[model samples]
Target: MAHSSNDEFFAKLVELFDYRKGKDHGSIVLTQKRLTYDQPLPEATSDTILPDLHPPQPMPILIRATNAKGKEKRRAKEKVKLSTVVDADNLPAFFERYAEVCKVGMNTLKPRDRRRKGKAKKKKGGAAAVGGP
Candidate 1:
């Protein structure tokens, strides 16, 4: 999961760690000497006070819009535009908008998929028979 901000990522990491440990009663230990700008695998294990491992630091978010032709497009031209950085307070709104845009895009891509099952069955003259008994 790509995070829009370091703070958000950190918060999620803490939450995940706490959940994994089954109890939030330990200090997070960063034994790994190097800290890179990337999101660590959620399953990474750490042998520290906090049994669960910390999520790796995430890099800055990059906002890039693409056109129907698969070419990069300007944010203004795209139907959905995400900000480069978002804090916890605004993250929910950002996600809500993002999900809405994704839903719209998916709907536009396959409108037929939204058809009712009964309507589809009726159009196809009921369920087709499978292999003979």
Candidate 2:
């Protein structure tokens, strides 16, 4: 990309990852041959582990920065494709890992209190601004 931020971009990525942590996954019916007892998505069992859902991440965005020196620094952007580039068989492992992350709780990965403080500040300032000086 045009190389502007490190923390901002990584923070965005972490947020994206957290959102994906509790991914809602649907299971495929392998044996449609009919079962005797009913089979709904099982509740959390002692042995079974349901991992979080995190789709394979896309490649980083590529940016082109024009104007070598001086004030005018216009930038053009190019979006890269979001493809897993992995074999179909190996995809199952990804799902399994996601489930594990879900089991562990996604909140742990969040950036912590700074986000909340920022929101609170914005709300306070926004309210005052909306009301008066």
Residue-wise C-alpha lDDT for candidate 1, range 1-133, written one tens digit per residue? 3423534434443443344355424232221122233534455345544422444443323332222222354344533222235433555675566455445433223354355676566765433422223
- Candidate 2, position 49, lDDT: 60
Cα lDDT listed for each candidate: 0.39, 0.36
Highest-lDDT candidate: 1
For model 2, residues 1-133, the per-residue Cα lDDT tens digits are 2333433433333444454456563111111121112333445555556511222332232212111222332223222111122234444564465355344544444353356566667798656645763
Least accurate 10 contiguous residues by lDDT in model 1: 26-35
Error of 1 at 95 (Å): 0.7
Q: What's the TM-score of each model vs. the native?
A: 0.31, 0.19
RMSD of each: 16.8, 19.1
| TM-score attained by model 1 | 0.31
Runs off by more than 4 Å, candidate 1: 1-63, 68-83, 112-133
Cα lDDT of candidate 1 equals 0.39
